[model samples]
Target: MAGRSIEPFREIGGRLALVRKAYGLTQRQLAERVGRPASYIAKLELAERRLDVIDLEELARALDLDPGLLLSRLMGKDPI
Candidate 1:
């Protein structure tokens, strides 16, 4: 799945971790905000998983960021 990925999981993971930390939310707190399990957030931040569109949208809303920015960065495109 990682090899077939369209988004750069490493960069996404790093950014996601940074944004989450910047908001002062733990993995569990973010997951709770998005109605997901804490493990899901942890896996993404650890680069052990990739988020589907819905997950990305929910995460963006939870982090108060635009989903486009996250998707752009994850896909290696300019965040225009």
Candidate 2:
């Protein structure tokens, strides 16, 4: 998988951006809630960074959402 791009996960970033906008939270605000820098949030939203399980949980909590539901949305699936 050398040089393989992360394009497949790009939609997750798009979904994250939409959710963040829907909640009326700026990237900096969300980063503050997650104890990360604004640039980190920007990177995630741009798919320039990959999200790990721990970060996903933290982001879900900060967004007042269930982690599973958030993951489902990120994966482009309807939440069950």
Candidate 3:
């Protein structure tokens, strides 16, 4: 585990879940706020779908996070 670089999708997925949890928001709640499907959120959390910058920004905003911090964390860099 130590030597492995985190995969982009997995990192993003993890960050998504973490931010959602940090805000005490359920997937359904986040999905509703984002105007996306709950299943879509679930798929994103599972890394089953690709995420984009726009979606990243939207998610970060919804969770009251810095977009850059979310992207950096998702890329496995130390969040600034």
Best model number under lDDT: 2
Backbone N/Cα/C clashes per model:
0, 0, 0
Model 3 residue 54 CA deviation (Å) reads 1.2
| TM-score for each of the candidates | 0.79, 0.82, 0.79
In candidate 3 the C-alpha lDDT for residue 13 amounts to: 85
Give one digit per residue, the lDDT tens place, for model 2 in 1-80. Answer: 46977764476677678789999999999999999899998998888888778888899999998776656754668653
Error of 2 at 14 (Å): 1.1
Ranked by lDDT, top first: 2, 1, 3
Name the lDDT of candidate 3.
0.80
RMSD values for the candidates in order, in angstroms, are 2.8, 2.4, 4.8
Whole-model lDDT values for every prediction: 0.81, 0.81, 0.80
Off by over 4 Å in 3: 1-6, 74-76
lDDT of 1 by residue, 1-80 (tens): 53675347766777788888888999999999999899999999877887778888899998888887765764668643
TM-score of 1: 0.79
